[model samples]
Target: MKISEFVKQVNTTKDAVRHYEELDLLRPSWKNDVRYYSPKDVGDFHAIKEMQSVGFSLKDVQAIFNLKRTDGCGSEKLIQGFLDSLDKELEAVVKAEEELQQKKSKITNMILELKQL
Candidate 1:
């Protein structure tokens, strides 16, 4: 499909899609300067969106995509790298959650002390 259809199908702005193309993150088959996206591109679009949602920077996404292209999706090293990134992210989230919970507990204790006065 054309860029318009591709953007609509992927539920993303044309500018964002263009930016992805410019970043070498997403590529559609091109002919005469026109881009045509295959149905399979839908999966690619979802994958990109998913990565972005999980706090993966465009550069990180690009690296993963490059690895997949060069070594195939089933490559153990690529899978390990992805898993490592996720693990790091998870650790950060867990730490943040712990800090927030501690803050909440402190606030609750303060409120209880004020009520006792």
Candidate 2:
């Protein structure tokens, strides 16, 4: 498919795909002036997006691709470290949200008491 169609199908912008291409994340099979993407390319594009959504930087994603290209596998230890860090961050976020909720409830009660006065 053409870049435009691929963008539409993937629900992404042309610039984003171009940026991915520039990062060597994904490339067209044929680069004879006009670019075309294959189904595999689309899958690779989705993988990049998914990784980004889950806190993987483009550089990290590129490293994964390089590893795969050269050795057919990414570093398990690196991926595990990311997962462990993400777990700790998620715990912190959840605790912060719970504290915020408690604070909100206290503020709401204060407002109600002032209204009653």
Candidate 3:
């Protein structure tokens, strides 16, 4: 499909799609000066959004994509690398959760003190 149709199908803006194209994250073929996106490109867009939702930066997503393209999808090395990244992200999320819990506890105690005043 064309860019407009692809944008509507993906529920994203033209600029966003263009940006992804510029980043080499979305590969659209050009014919007669018009860009055309395929179903695979649509899948790529969803994969990009899903990764971002999980707190992966565009650079991180790019690296993951690159690994998949370089090594076959079923390559053990790619699986190991992705697993390592997931482990690191999980650690960061756990640490952030602990910090948020500490802050919540402090806020609850302060609220109780204010109620006693």
Model 3 local distance difference test score: 0.91
* Quality of model 1 by C-alpha lDDT: 0.88
The lDDT for every candidate, in the order shown, is 0.88, 0.83, 0.91
Q: What is the lDDT of residue 24 in candidate 3?
A: 82
Candidate 3 lDDT, 1-117, residue by residue in tens: 999999999999999999988888998999999999999999999999998887888888888888888998879988898888888888989999999999999999999999999
| Ten-residue region with minimum lDDT total, candidate 2 | 72-81
Per-residue CA lDDT of candidate 1, range 29-69, in tens?
98998999988777888998998898788888998889888
Distance (Å) between predicted and true CA of 65, model 2?
1.1
lDDT score at residue 100, model 1, on the 0-100 scale: 100
Ranking according to TM-score, highest score first: 3, 1, 2
Candidate with top lDDT is: 3
TM-score per prediction, in order, is 0.91, 0.65, 0.95
What's the true lDDT of residue 25 in model 3?
Answer: 94
Q: Which stretches of candidate 3 lie over 4 Å from their true place?
A: none
**Colliding residue pairs in candidate 3:** none
User: What TM-score does candidate 2 reach?
Assistant: 0.65
Shift of residue 51 alpha carbon in model 3, Å: 0.5
Residue 89: error of model 3 in Å?
1.4
In candidate 1, what residue range of length 10 has the lowest lDDT sum? 37-46
